[model samples]
Target: MTSVLALTAATAQADAFNRIASFPTHLNNAEANAESSAEIISATADGMTLVYSDSPLEVIGLIDITDPANPKAKGNIAVGGEPTAVSVIGNTAFVGVNTSESYTAPSGMIKAFDLATMTETAVCDLGGQPDSTAAAPDGSFIAVAIENERDEDLGDGRTGQLPGGFLVTVDVVDGSLDCDTVNVIDVTGIAEISPEDPEPEFVDINAAGEIVLTMQENNHMVVATKDGVINHFSAGQVDLENIDATDERGALVFTESQPNRLREPDAVQWIDDNHFAIANEGDMDGGSRGWTIFNKDGTEVYENGTGFEKAIIAAGHYPDKRSDSKGVEPEGMEFGIFNDTPMAFILAERSSIVGVYDLTDPSAPVLAQLLPSGVGPEGAVAIPGRNLFVTANEVDLIEDGGVRSHVMIYELTDAAASYPQLTSAGTDELIGWGAISGMSAGAGSTVYAVNDSFYGYQPTIFTIDTATTPATITDATVVTRGGHPAQKLDMEGVYFDGEGFWIASEGRTDRMIPHGLYHVDMDGNIDAEIPLPAELLAVERRFGFEGITRVGDTLWMAVQREWADDPENHVKLVAYNLETEQWGAVHYQKADPDTGWVGLSEIVAHGDYVYVIERDNQIGGAAVTKKIYRIAAADMVAAPLGDDLPVVSKEEVRDLIPDLTSLNGYVVDKIEGLAIMEDGTAWISTDNDGVDDSSGETYFWSPGKF
Candidate 1:
């Protein structure tokens, strides 16, 4: 059964999660230059404030969500140690601090703070490293998972090290912790694997005062009643079929199988007194790549095998680079009753998506929605009273000039779902597409786009139908050479010729991929290959052709950046005559960068002029130039190679900053595709870097009939 949450605008009008606001973690950091992250979030009883643990900064950051549409940063509080988890009861926040010196001597504490005064109230020594914390639903006590946490490099990265983990329960009276009432419960010899090293990963309590814990490395589950009586069971394993089990292969193939794969669960949440759910984020031996529901007595109720993964692939959010490690990596989970319906929110850490399931019937839950999160969603909190949902994304890519760690807010409303602007849901077969570099208009409303070097082993041209809202990919044709999947090709651009497509393969000479052009038939069979002339090859750089377009008998290629022989702030618009068999060039002056370098990304020819996408390499707020400029055909006079190329004048057609941020996200760096239809309607798209270290959000829309 394909568990696809096929949500469209018309069908999602009842109640859906729609993103309303995003707050970057850096806004609360005092250093401004230091990296910070938002992880393990908890909300106040009023549901107006959010607090998250920031281990990198050794602090706990706060955000005011009174107005869910405009989240305000409340700054950070120094915790003096690594804060592992946080939970709130009334006006006080309970934080678990890890101060472990070594695996053999793990030590930590539980720090309680008063929200009104913003001061520490009390602390209880846990005597072990704490990983997760949860407050009793009735506010009577708090539970902490004391994970001694074995070192992966020691003993082959398995468990069974010294000082096994345990659980700590503390009495809470009027939002204040009673340090003397702390009770430690030993959870040893519970699982079949590494029974001596029960590394407790997560904890949650139900309304009946029963605490459930997950021993991730041990592949075990434990349930402790309020009176300290415990029952334990093994998480067990499952048979996985139709999965991509290899890593970094530059392709997505789901034909492999892994039988008896262990479900080393990470985050567990009690849905009711008798049932709960676990995110199977395996640690030592296995990760099943999906979630499972279990009865309180360890009876397997429902296991969503590869169905959840298939849905993520259909939505174009699969993480191909993590195929071998843990596909999608479902790491966090939260359960709540919203609008009288029990809902489960499962967080896929690598894919940066939140899967919302309606648990009206726990035996067979319905996949309702898939919410787009930040780069890595590690924790989630549901504010059902306010009809709101919050997620803490833990990835901060500041060093790579990418978006910082963010906390995203979503509201449950009757409005239609706004995310997933592009999907492969209605296609004949499952299609995965990302890193869209260049595009060309085909017959009618169809457009053809090519993936870049990210999928070097499976170069494919995708056919997108723009007539549908949130355009859908209808077909994908694998680009072939000698009747086999092409290799060593970094296809950046595609142009629909009279018979087939003229493709521009951006080359890296260091990797032996020469800068060249290839003509492929409609069936994706290469018919001809043309190498750069001697004059251009001598001056070529790794940043070669980015886009290609055909104008009558000539083909124009937009050089991405300045070559060895080009002037500063200018790149060549090289032209090759199909009939004359000659090569020439013209320089197109680009904008100077405010921080990083700027260059051209795409080129297209219309009636009387040609349009090109010019952008800066900087992302988010640091970006300066992301626009479309046009050069009149009369000024595109190609000069012979080895001679001074005449520079062409440009006219600004559109400023794309608004379009890039229209979806309420930080601006992406790669605006690499442009397609104009026969009716003069213009369309543009941004490359998602194949969801590798990316938010996996692709924007494909028009700038109002340019």
Candidate 2:
């Protein structure tokens, strides 16, 4: 078994990064309905202001980090086209604007804005579509990666689609760009894979006036000096073993292997003048699922193999759905020296995690911490002068009513890491778990929880030990049928039945998964399946059973939303008798949502009441109701279905908004699991939607006596 002693003691460290604030990108836009994003962020010389490229809004957003704990929006400036990247030198912000007409006819420019006046000061025609921009440390010149990125749909998505890309270097004096001195460096015949198409994805300049660039699709790297002389090398390849290589399989199996995988790096940053690090975010055929450190002479110093992805898996942040592709997709990276210690921050695009590593010994870097970001962290900026680090998350989920793109800020201090409130870290085998849907108290301080349909092919029951500071998942049991993992189950609720457990599967008729109750032994072996009766099935909707609780010989199930036969704002509390095998129901009134629909998420029977978690479908600031209400156990008399059921009265037990926002993140929509112990200690958790377009932040906390 993996040793828990070290993992538990590691939490006592006093030096770590802690998130302080999050600023939504939409706040910079004048229209609330329009979608916005924060990508490719850069900080000013004073390290008090932040500027990010917003491609969807075609603008560059500015934020005042004068007070890093509570960032304020400073509005946006139109870049006239899609803003791809931004870099701030002194008080001026240089943005790369993409105005591509087609893959064959790519066009872009570099627009410099005076942040003090919020006005465009200079515009230099880049002569091709640009992907990334970087300013020299000495402010002598600025480098732009003219990507002329390939059209994935054309020519089988290869890089050799012609009209290849190059690099541009422009002189800068007194914080102003001299457009007349723009120099376009031709970078062709560089790599054997795509010798004709050089798609430079990212650029970074060191203190020695040398520029390092990554041609992502071509799988090559180029180091250009001040005189425009270039030294190019192939990014090379890696052999991957013990990884999950199948996509959409609904399970995480790491027995697969892929040999000779290309390290098609995306983002590169110089740790010093002689060495640099590259995030191997492969495009088509590779993604080593790690970062690499290399010398200026093309000698590989260190290759992280599957170590980074494995760490993410231990933190329950692995994107199992993207297993077949670039797992975790480490895309952006930043290097800085904080407290005299060199550090490297690696951003995982798919996992939404930022790995902070201490480069005290360049050859042997140590992972310090893993901080959670918004949905997709596209870029990061580290300001050691202020002991601050920032990430620009580029995903805007407005269409799904989810949290918008955010710019998360973290402060480096002598404090313990406040994140990763829950983990399966010390387990003997890696336990990849998320989307915690239902929970029930087991024997003593133990609790049993089940994952939703996100792991449909590997439905599991996790055993948690809640005595630790951050609860630990001690073991996992796969809910199996005929010795095989049960399939087509969207388990939403689970209840302890004195021996084993009774699970409620929320059905989706469209997906061929039916609504039912399952009886499983302690080992998670499905002994029986009980389908919903015809009387309830006739009125059932996709939002069926959400929670289950047992009292005496009756099983109580909370229906998620209103059904066809139920009154408006009223859902049924279904009851099933174990002795008589009869079904009954009771009406439970819920508050009407102001924007989205309100529904019941969890149900748990306590000493004198049945506690239910009532929530709305809306997330973030739009959420109206996230509460727990209790119904008197004496009022749980069930009436036969197909008749007017007695409406149960409820008393507000707690408003979960405070607990949801306790970590400073926006309110999540899914508060789907609750487990109350015999001592009245209640534990609650939120569903992360299996980290699919979600922040992948599962909040598990105890509200004390309920």
Candidate 3:
């Protein structure tokens, strides 16, 4: 008889052991999850899987589920696109790719291959981009989710945009039919829930072909038929009985709360046919905890426990879990057979471990064991034929210009057993050099990693390698890029088009200013540095440039204004086209001495618009508004030519720039960096400057139509 352990009792949190106990003094700079929807999930034979890539480019990884409690390292695959999800049927695996570069084509690629042989078969370019995908039950078709964005520029310098996400069915078997393979199924109503707009976090298709589960990440649940469009439903509104429930059909609806104060929703999972569970793990300060179990009809049958309420009862201590638990950010999850029974595989996202839990009882999940080898586990899948589970552990951080990642595999004796022993499937590392930030892989052992400097001052880049071992930097070498000493510059944000690396730089230290653009060649050589206007540079010196994004051949920058005594002074976004040498601006009202202008800071471009981050004045007793601004390229088409730029008094301009005041209802903080998304939204990061309520805060905003 298979061992039956009580899997629903909360594991005793015994003093909260540090997962990184060996690697003390590890860097712990936490940035908010700017793009939540693009988590790529792939599994290898070693039971390893790729979760979410931290960098701006593509990341692929693996996890070990052979022993659900002991997931270990395999390696990472660095592809050139913004990879969102992975699907495998038999030996052939399909990868979904996305691109966030504004100037580049909005294209996606599907890489199909024989995972068993590790051989490349075909590369299909999906002109219609995709975010995540699920394989059909019979393996004849694939349900791919694509997102189309619309920007609505608010005349007041702030713009808003909404996501129009849809699903496409792609044929996996016939590579020739891949060109005209997609069949569109609109998911706008299911995804567009918020007045501001809603983004789909993750979408999965069941093996039985009965239901497709799409986790919106922030809001409700979206359920669709195999060939039917997804029908949106709130987690609070899920009617379980309306559909047939099974690990194959109903197992995708699990919920886990965010561990941070940002209040993003938790990861979700499905327990069984009659029961589904949502983990309300709560955000920072142990905000909330409990499992909400619902029947087929969507009624809350019971809540087993609250956050620390249950943890305290089991182990004791006010549990402090952030959204991405440093131990594991709960993002990717899977429920499959274990030892002839169903088990839940949860990747403690960001955490280097895959958790095996007995979810037979939906109300309370018993922690079977914590697998300890994977890094950044996002998604996991179990293969019954081989009795193996695989996870993608994305580890794309460059400490000293080296890449370190592995595709780990784990083998299990029983596919339906709750927690069996996990064994390795031989780790395969995708070795290469340069600072890796993100990764993805294509057919024929093609691996990619987004490369960027750890310091905020390096050129954004992506490096390609085909090594079967984890990537690493063996020596400390001086590198030159973009006509500048790579060692001397500060840079962040990187993307990889199929041809070359698409990089962006925050440019400077100051907040309210504009910076120049620089491009790096494939051989790590700096080809050009498009300088900003001397006059603009002079004015920006008082402020500082933030985000530099590529939208096709043109680059966009958000120009945040400095503070002044008359709070009404404002901020602006400046767009510079690399192709046409044209520039434009989207201006916001200077804060009324009574109201604050809190100028825009970090700005990134997406498609046709630029999104800018706004921060309040740094000085206390000033405007308190904290918002992001969205500017369109159309409105900012005509810019002041640099050749005919005007000369200005630096001393006077600097003095006036600092004296600007802001309006009420806004916080006056030093808003710093920016990043753009493929879906036209923008991300902003602020500087603390040793101030209160101002450290480590990130914001997301989008541009509207011109």
Candidate 4:
């Protein structure tokens, strides 16, 4: 018994990196609805403090991570220019400040500040716009990539403009920068793509003091020492297959190919003294949609090809809107060795995920995990000594009432992975899924769910296995009409009735998506579509059926909000009889608005009650109502449509605020899915809004037996 107990305890403590906390960038600004950002990040030598560059706010922000699980905002420092990147070494912070007046007259400065006093100590004129800043492992020097980035509006955004960019190295002596020892290396006439304009994108230094850089727009890379450039080569091209190459189609079809696709690498990080990796976040021409490891002598050690993109797809993070340009857009990366395991973290900008790979074998890296990022992760830093990783998400959608820019902290601990709470990792075919709106429990551990209008062109029904950790999406079936992929559907609910599924679609008349219900067989063939009745359609104001479920011979639909004729704060729980083909509804008393309007998102029938999710549209701190309410099954009597409907009373089942905040993230707005099983266990989920102006975090968790 002792040995068995010891083994169980050992297994319970895992060796993985899990997110501990997130600090919003606007916290340091003291401004509400401020347009702030956290772009590139760095940390002090002890890893107790963090510094990030906020370009739009023109400041360098600081955070005290003395307690990694509870990061506190230290405040922001004015840099007097657009701070593009920052690197911290001991007590000094070397920041690359871009003061470029125009594309042709590009100029910037690399400034060093005392972290304690928060004052500028030394500065060096970079002679061009700087992109990435990195410090040598031994803290001997700092390297800045002088990008002098091109103006996309001018000359069709192609490179080869005048005043080519170069690399600058500043000596760091006694933990302080020495502006006099700054060495500039001319990196021109190297790459075959644009030899005249070599715009360096990212830089990294190894323990051996060798600095490596990537010229993204030029599709090139360079290796240099303090004295001069040693070797230069093309970032190279890849023939990508099985990729979704078309955008605005609202579907994930990986049948297209981009032949000889250029790998416009964006971020570079050294794995060791001999090898390094680059994130191919292409500009101008191409983005390989993955990462690559290369030897110091220009040999391709490992080419990710489409592997990383496919993994992102499996995690339900495929950004269909960016399919034509760069899918997911692998942009930032960091490498570290923790607990004898060498790992490389690659950031997917558009999908808002960090793909963690075990680089034990650089030539054959194993993708270990995909952690959810806040949104638009632009830069990252890995502190192996402290067993921590950090990401700076650059996009702040405050004006749009979206989540603010956040610097997420992940700590390597003896705890299991807590993110990606839902995935399609082991499915038969690669299934891209998101916007999980409504769900219904089936036999045993199976649950059926549907995607909303965000993927309107490809209506789909997903089968979920609740028995697995992260709740696996086992299969996906696209709803079809006459053997063609059904388009213009905003599927909000799905129900499995032993042999087939009942689907509810939430529509918008302006966008041409209809509000209706679908009877789909097991094979995804639509047997019939049930449109709203004349009276219901006349009163509809785009807030249509959000969920559907069955009881005896009746199909109950939860109208999202109050219609034109319904009383204030009362939504319709419409019912349809399969045998009688009649439409009726009962008024559901919803809560009054605290910040935004409250409405029902999902409905499920089981045992002796009918469950519904009532939530407010507000997110973060403004969110007030995100609850599960139940009404006795006997009270679900339906009155005829367009009449004075009887109101149904409800009792609160569970308060979902604590559940949504359990992940240590900002409270998401939509709580659209709820499913109760035979064992009385309940499952809840949220919609990610198709990752558009959203963090793209789909929370799927169980509230236990209800």
Candidate 5:
């Protein structure tokens, strides 16, 4: 069954996971700019606290989740090595730390710490690098995946390197980790590929004291108890059709194929004693781009195929840059039962989203919801007793001056799913969309939106029906030339006139994309193109027209940043008289940046006022200038382009930071789209940066009347 988030808000309200809070990992460190990550996460026995492996900080971070809606930073403790995975039994935390000197001679330790005191209690030498750890349900023992991972630079990056990996079982004596009772079980020579060097990726123990293991690089799987290996099988391969198999081309094309793609499972979780699920996040040779459920005997009970990736694409979270390697990259899996329903949480690593699958029928699981996540979700834990679920995002963009990693908390309640504030889930085809730059209120209860240059080859005008609760994209009209996808267009602004549209293209002369305007008919055929005048073109920078609005016979455009001739913290509101064919400008004073440069992103004229979205390049806690400002329509008087310009007075309409963080996510930087309808309702949206170096979250909402 090809279902991608088929549940609507009305149907999902019976029971659903809604995000309540986002805690930044850097908050645990004293330094504000410290780089940290929340990789593998586990909850305490009481489900009142959480612990996660932070590899970059060489520590394990702790959080007090007694109040799931307001998680507090319990601080991090130095483990003296790279913490790769963690699991909690009772009040003690078991952390797998990699102290490997090199890939040829792997060395690791299972470190135990008291969560209440944050002090080291014990350490067990594992003699190999550990990747994942799982605690038994009854607190009897713990399982660790000893992945003596191969060096990618060495040879073809295959798994058959020296010092093959194995499994370690540690007995929990008296409800605590007993390092002296550590036992090793050989897991080599069990699979068809790279049997000598079995790189165990993840492990999960069922109630029957059996461990389910996935050797990702070796393309193998195994089921073993403390005694020895019971069963083993190849992860096998899949034949995929209608997938985007090309990367870094700045487009979304899903007509390619990967035949016999290897299903290199990365993370596995036990659905029950007889069955388990694995996320097929491949290594070097393959990534099936989906998840699968398997019986203990290695028989496939269900395989999602391309259904999960299709849902991510529809939610505008598709990472086209990783398409050739893995589409959406399903890397983490969590199984939990909340309110008498078995649910599976599948995380898309590259897309930064979680696919909620209702496993009422393990053989025919249904895609129930898709929740937005922080960038690069690597681990997840479910506390069903408290009706809660959590995710540890591992990507920290400190070097890129972006948002830090975060641990997001979600609670199951009788309320609608708040994420995917906008979606194209029910579209006819796979309408892949992102980087929503501008919008215009269309006729009736509809809105017209446009994607920026991220999808350069697929310039589109999206028709959104606001009549729905979260709004829905009903149609996508591709702007074309001679019946083919247009070229050299960086559509940043769009205005839907009664009969057609006027689009603005931001210039990047370095990339051969010119700064200009286009007049198109309703059929998306370009009727005319208008280039910038010599006066404006000679003084242009990378920042150009961000939005456009029509007032009588004059069309006004908002420039993103100040040009050469503009004053400090002042940008031009360029205007073109359609009847006179003349160009002129008026100045709009913008805010002085507290951290980074601030500028305008959109402009919309409604009634007797003109609204604009002014924001800064900073994100998360560093954000300050995301707001809406308006100017009286009577104050917009344009002067000659080469002469002195008059500055228009503006009033602060609204502060958008509150609404931006309403969904319990890090504040995104781009507040690009704004639409004002005839009923005094104004809609606002943020750009997802085409899911590159971003959380792939687009916040679309209405501030009532801004």
Candidate 6:
């Protein structure tokens, strides 16, 4: 029996740095603040910190963190501008101040503050402007991601070019407040990493004095010199299991043995100046556990084996638990593997568990620990000084009351030391009103969380916790999105380009019916909505879309078509052109009378190719060959829709893509959705919404001919 003394010992020690404290509170997992944007700047040993966007110059809030137990309110910084990125360097704080009432472009300001004096140090005027900023360790340089006035229109309503933004390095060598041209790294020239498109997110930089690493949201990392020179050798997709780049020359050395898919890379950290860890929120629809590890040279060091493999192994060992526990939906991750083993602190989105992995052995890592929390946990950061791992609980608020948003802190306990297990260690919930989505760390260890009301009934953007002086969460100012809910339901994923975000809303309601694609600006407003035609909208019981991908201005959606006639009818693929607003659909067809498609689950386009996940019709009472169809987009567009209506026969589709019987692995259940990784690999998900079978699982399909 577990004794009282043992239980007390298992309890986490109260550290003034790691404890959870409530300060500036608001709505959570709610619709009220739909379009609200919150981001975590940094986490410290004394207390955790954050920053949120409100409106005007009152858009900055400061919270006190002297006591981890109770985070007090320090005050507010009236920057009189809509702040975008919040970072702190020494006694000075930096914020991306926008002039527009909402988050538009015309003018912007780079406001500097003396955290000690709590006064503005300097302000620089710029256009298009800085989206995100990273301060140099010694306070020498501040690298800002800037774009030439957002130009061009991507059907979705956002105005950034194919590779819109550029990186501008500001020289802070002299304490001059005057604005002058420093250095700029033009991203417009960078080749599209993925054959499909490229959406790069500049992650963390190495603390090493010389070299800094910037990782993309889509999983590409580029090492740059302090002078803004790109180390092309160190740039590529994060595919390996483990990657460490600690050499003084800023050389990226990786594991050259085996390679794998590096899911959605949301965060990156330096292990010790060389070795680093990447947080991959594995693809849900694609059935990847998400997180993986890579060395500096772009080789995969550790991977959460394909989703199906993990499920198979888990079921083999803990069949009972496997039957109930939905596998990990990993997202933002920080390295802190339990029991002195190489581990990762994974943000499991769906299960809302902080999953710990023991990657002592890169190839086959074990599920170390899983700390439970509120719904839809996204980004996470490991603050070793505080012995606490924090996660952004970005839950979707579909119900009226709204699920509470959370900035959760979990104290790393020794319970796993004596008995290293994957379990919860209790969490301290902080202020969260709207769904807290994205998170990042800035100067001064200030943690910033983005509270995005993407799918809420109302849209607003707010900045919480302005300065690190005392570390208090202050709502900088409130920026509203015209005050109308884009009515986006089940908003699942969020990607920040510094300028704003391309948020993915997994619309799962009859109200919105099928689902739609939306764009929310940095200042909390629905810039525009790109939706499918009424035909694509899943009727009473029909097709529903879940996944989306945008390349340049081109957008692709993966929609699942339900059997409308006999429950055994095949599904169709709908492809829409963001430019001309043209729509084209391809229905599944099979030559064999018995091997017909019951449903068409997912659609993904890369280069000139397009792939679709097809659900199989019953074969001998069991699903056989749920295939992935690779068709040329041009050919798809050329396919006749028959008198302006989408209708295709099984035999016609069979003729379009030959050999349906010769695909890779097979799923015996309903294949629902699909998503493509940064590395061109495909991940598919299954739905058991109706079946009594526990066959609802995800699978990873490698890049190959089907």
Q: Could you give candidate 2's per-residue lDDT for residues 594-631 as a string of tens digits? A: 99899999999999899999999998889889999999
Say what the RMSD of model 5 is.
3.2
* 341-441 per-residue lDDT for model 6 (tens digits): 45566655544445566566666666653454444555555556556665554443323223334444555544322111111111121111223332222
Tens digits of lDDT, candidate 3, 598-646: 5544444555555444555533333354444455545544436333222
RMSD of 3: 24.2
Measured with C-alpha atoms, the lDDT of residue 419 in candidate 4 is: 70
Q: Encode model 1's per-residue lDDT on 149-229: one tens digit a residue.
A: 998999998887988999999999768999999999988876788888789999999999999999998888999975664
Instruction: Predict model 4's lDDT versus the native.
Output: 0.88
| CA displacement after TM-score superposition, residue 477 of candidate 4 (Å) | 1.6
Worst 10 residues of 2 by lDDT: 1-10
lDDT of 5 by residue, 427-485 (tens): 77778888999999998889999999888888899998877766788888899989998
- Candidate 4: how many backbone clashes? 0
Task: Judging by lDDT, tell me the better candidate of 2 and 3.
Answer: 2
* Model 5 misplaced stretches (Cα beyond 4 Å): 1-12
Candidate 4 at 219: error in angstroms? 0.7
Model 2 steric clash pairs: none
Please list the Cα RMSD from the true structure of every candidate, rounded to 1 decimal place. 3.2, 3.1, 24.2, 3.2, 3.2, 23.7
Worst 10 residues of 4 by lDDT: 1-10
Query: What's the lDDT of the predicted structure labeled candidate 6?
Result: 0.42
Candidate 4 lDDT for residue 50: 93
TM-score, structure 1 vs. true: 0.97
